[model samples]
Target: MVDTNRITGAAKDIGGKIQGAVGDLTGSKHDSVEGRLREAGGQAENLYGQAKDTVRHAADEAYHYAEDFYEQGGHSLRRGTREVSRQVAEYPLASLVVAGLVGFGLGLLVNASRD
Candidate 1:
């Protein structure tokens, strides 16, 4: 996952430095300016690549964290369901009473909403 832009930018920066040095030795302002411009462009490209890499890494981390959280949530739900089932089986009459109460409460809520 080496970024091409980063590599290209580094090469351009090196070339620009050499060009600038030659321009200085030959007393050519045009060459010097061109070299400076190239150097700046290379720096911008390198920064862009670095930013892209940072964002991608952050997104990958967030995705993995969310995936782990979801898996844990699922496991917790399954365990809770199993516990409830076992409790209901161990106390059938109590479970029936609780179910009746819940139904009655839901019916009350529905009637209140209608009113």
Candidate 2:
């Protein structure tokens, strides 16, 4: 994305240079000083635009990274669920026993916490 401030700042800088040159030709110190100040302001605006672009780019990269990470995580979770489903279908009795054991363990943990 192009920054408008950068373009505006560049135009301002060019205008300042021309103004300063004209001031010099006419021997006007005040106009020359004003032109230099305008140039400095333009440079500052350009720098601000650059900084904003850098931050925006960084944010975009981070958002893409997070999006990719979440997509991968979701894929892994789906794969894991499918694997567990296949395993339970292959060994229903074993799966039931494992579930019972897990429930009993959780109950024990809960009771212990109450004490």
Candidate 3:
């Protein structure tokens, strides 16, 4: 996942350094200043590339985490449904009573909210 910008930026930075060195040895102020500017630009590009890589990595991790969560939630919901079905089948009368009570409680809550 290494970015091309990082590679090119590093190469450019190295070239700038060499240029600056040569300019200094030859006593050319213009070349030296220009080399410094190029070096700065290269460093900036490298930093930008690094930032992009960090963001991409985070996005990938988040996607995988969400996918795993969805799968686990689906499995748990299916398991819960099976358990509830078994319990209701085993105690039909009790299940009916409980369902009625829940409905009544919900109705009461709704009526109270309206008031």
Q: Best-fitting candidate, measured by TM-score?
A: 3
| lDDT computed for candidate 2 | 0.89
- Candidate 2: stretches off by over 4 Å: none
Question: Clashing pairs in model 1?
Answer: none
Stretches of candidate 3 off by over 4 Å are none
lDDT of 1 by residue, 40-93 (tens): 888888888888888888999999999999999999999999999999999999
Query: Model 2, clash count?
Result: 0
Q: Rank the candidates by TM-score, best first.
A: 3, 1, 2
Q: What tens digits encode model 2's per-residue C-alpha lDDT throughout 1-115?
A: 9678888887788778877888899999988888888888888888888888899999999999999999999999999999999999999999999999999999999999999
- Stretches > 4 Å off in candidate 1: none
Give the whole-model CA lDDT for all candidates, comma-separated: 0.89, 0.89, 0.91
| Candidate 1's TM-score | 0.91
TM-score of each candidate?
0.91, 0.87, 0.92
- Candidate 3 per-residue lDDT, tens place, 1-115, comes to 9887888888778878888888899999988888887888888888988998999999999999999999999999999999999999999999999999999999999999999
lDDT of 1: 0.89
Better of 2 and 3 by TM-score: 3
Clashing pairs in 3: none
Best by lDDT: 3
